[model samples]
Target chain A: MRYGGDNRGRLLIIVLLVTSLFLITLDLRGVQVIDGLRTGTQTALTPVQKAGSWLVSPFRNFLSDVTHLGRTRNQMEKLTAENEKLRLTLQNRKTADAQLKQLKGVLNLAGTAGYEVVNAKVISQGSTTSFTQTITIDAGTSSGVRANMTVLSGYGLVGVVKYAYRDSALVQLASDPAFKIGARIAGTQQIGILSGQGTRKGVLQLLDNTTQVRKGDVLLARGSQNGRPFVPGVPIGEVTSVDNSPGAVTQTADVKFYTNFSTLGVVAVVVSGSSADPRDSLVPPKPRPTPLPTVTIYATPGAVEPTPTPTATK
Target chain B: MSLRRFFYSFPIFFTVFLLQEAVVTQMRLPAGGINLLLVVALIWAALSTPEIGALTGFGAGLMMDVSQTSPGPMGHWTLVLIIACYAIAFLGYGDDNIRGNPINIIFLVTIGVVAAQTVFLLLGMMLGQQVGSVSNIAFLLAGSAFWTAIISPLILKVISFFHANIFGMRSQL
Candidate 1:
């Protein structure tokens, strides 16, 4: 209830605010000192956080299960027989399919191209602030996981490992605005840079203006010299739409990713790709485009003109 | 600020921080996730003195920054939370009734969450992050604020019970 002028309290608040601003400035400026502090603190707390996660996950599961207990019980009893019958029916088919694919030289071979991978569990999704699109996996440096290692689900590329602690590591999702990959269009072999649009869809910027890419064309990572961060031929996504801006030097298109980041479960970390973090090749993020106020029409006879939609093309 | 107050409230902040990161964050809602820690900080700040409020907010924000998975400028949350806690404490300095009324706590939490999130978004944009369109950020802020408000009362009651039991004081509610 002390609302009166307290100079000491005011001074303390100012000091705290100033200190916070200083920390932010230092971090933004990429001060090596603060980076060390961040790394050290993160390393020290990883164990405690991991232990806390272990203790809390079961309780969380129990709470969720209880909430859906009635429906779950009803479905469980009904599905038990069906599950057994389906399991028996699919077992032989799965084995036969695997044998067939092995006999043929046409399998999505994960480690065929001199890259070693380790499977890791997606323990957590996103960050506490939720400002960045990232996830934490259970594997870390202890399990040969390191920074800049490519992470993927069964479908395709997910992201690259950003940081690795002793027992855990952080994976920056491919949908993060800052993420980019050098990719090539399947069949056409046209090179382009794929960047995240901070959503499910990514934007692929073609290197050549004249490059012809169509919808449903699968994009693959054009892995670097050693394939460190991104290995060659990993499926990224399929092109959904191409931007046809008149007289544009570089063409852009919207890509729908094969990996579903929302429900990411078991992901593998490619431990032996690059000697160094290969993130430098990615193009720097451009500022979000300001929305257009109006549209212009170019009327022409005997030619159908597509409506020009304002978009950020870089 | 009394030493007892800081010691007593810090645990609640830490516990809330852990739960926010571990449990609450896992339930990713459509319009981004709700920040349960911000609500806890606001409520705790409202109940304590300005110094305690500011300190608690700083601790909570620091924990969040540490636990965050991505690499961005640190202390953004710390700065936002500290200022928000200070403002909340200033506004409720003489309002003893906030501690007793769960509805008031919910309302304060809703407003506080929105204010903190606005500062967070603006600062994030300033730091060269391509944080989507204004409408999208606004939608997320409002959704998260609403979700935080909905759960503020229950969370506050639990924290209050813990604080009371630990300190041998009567529960605020």
Candidate 2:
């Protein structure tokens, strides 16, 4: 009996050791067994995920409502201030009229680029403690949102679409570690690669060591194709700091993103188009002329004569 | 009977896995964020049989490894989670008390965080990646661990509710 028990224990130990060793080897080889398991897991959990997301939709809506309320308040305050300024400026009628004409001419000269604005909504977010800062938007192939398309809010650039599905797409923010954008300093035109470093921070790598990039300088997309895909001069971020390492060939700077990602609300997906064109969807619509009311004179001869007689008596 | 139980638990395990992938990852706190799935796994292990707990940990960890951006070996998380589950189980809390015990939860979280960081450090060293400053790693680990510890109770409560209401287990809580 004792011998039999000892044999069983040894067998159990052997089995455990063998299984662990097998798992380790499988792991080292980068085997797809885990991937298969993950797919299987995802498939099985899709319904639950959908349900959970639906249940949480109200919370997201509430958060969005709060965000929009704050934004509306800010916009109201801004518009009020602008209204006062415009009222003051209205005192100089001739100068204002000339400025308006010049602006209108410039707008008329600009032509439309190819793309149009199609609206999209955010659907889901990344999962993990490591901060998968990507957002999945509802716009997909059918919506004309393609991979590498730029997504922007009124504030500034939100992110670039990394992967697009038939009904949804994932956007990797400029703050994600994997994102890289070619940018130039707005003032000095120093070209550099803006790479995300996993945190909410990004580093700008300049080509020339003596590049004249300063704090508060704006960064814009470089080599924009007629400003269609990415509208040229759309503010990306402001340079926060510059770093020059001794003996290093190039200089680098940290950028403070214009978009307040922590409180992201509504964003507009700018389709490809020429920035010089007056057909920008973001531009306010032209004011329509008020139509004059037409009156038909019914010449009732008797009524007209009586009215003239009454007026003469008065 | 063991296989049947595993098969039954598969759906719950899969849901936790997907939640970790889809929702929990987006919650960013300073240093690092809380890994709610890890906390759930620890709690589940404590409330169940040790063998099953270890297996679940291994399975979930393997899924995490695949889902993560890390290009390293797949079973790295699996090994770490399994070891953590086993260690937590051996700490010898009674099944009934383990569910609501704050001390137990904290202990398990500490072990899990330590195990995870240690494994990652070792893997990084083996893979010839820059380990960065030791102080930085320590700071990150400590901060993340505290964050995870603080949130573990809430996660535990939610998982326990699910286990009881959905999975039909009678919980001590």
Best by TM-score: 1
**Candidate 2 residue-wise lDDT, B21-125, digit = tens:** 555543334455556667777776665545555666666666666553333455556666776765565453344454467567667766676666667557646
lDDT of 2 by residue, A1-314 (tens): 01122454345334443565576677667677754654454344444445555555545444444556765675446546666667345424533453355334223322222334545555455532332356655666767877677776544567777656556666777676556787877657778988765555678999888657787777876635655345554557778998867887889999877766654434445556453632223332335776655544455766734322222111
Q: What is the TM-score of chain A alone in each candidate?
A: 0.68, 0.55
Clashing residue pairs, backbone N/CA/C < 3 A, model 2: A111-A277, A127-B25, A128-B24, A128-B25, A228-A272, A228-A273
Model 2 spans with C-alpha error above 4 angstroms: A1-54, A57-118, A223-234, A268-314, B17-33, B47-50, B62-80, B90-102, B114-147, B155-173
Positional deviation of residue A232's Cα in model 1 after best superposition, in angstroms: 2.3
lDDT for position B81 in model 2: 70
Error of 2 at B155 (Å): 5.0
Q: Give the number of the best model, judged by lDDT.
A: 1
Docking quality category of candidate 2 according to DockQ thresholds: incorrect
Candidate 1 lDDT, A133-252, residue by residue in tens = 888888889999888888866667899989888778888889887788999887788999998866778999999988788988888888866666777777788899999989988999
Docking class of 1: acceptable
For model 1, the stretches where C-alpha displacement exceeds 4 angstroms are A1-4, A29-33, A44-77, A80-109, A112-114, A247-249, A274-314, B1-4, B26-31, B96-100, B133-139, B162-171
Candidate 1 chain A, which ten residues in sequence have the lowest lDDT sum?
Answer: A277-286
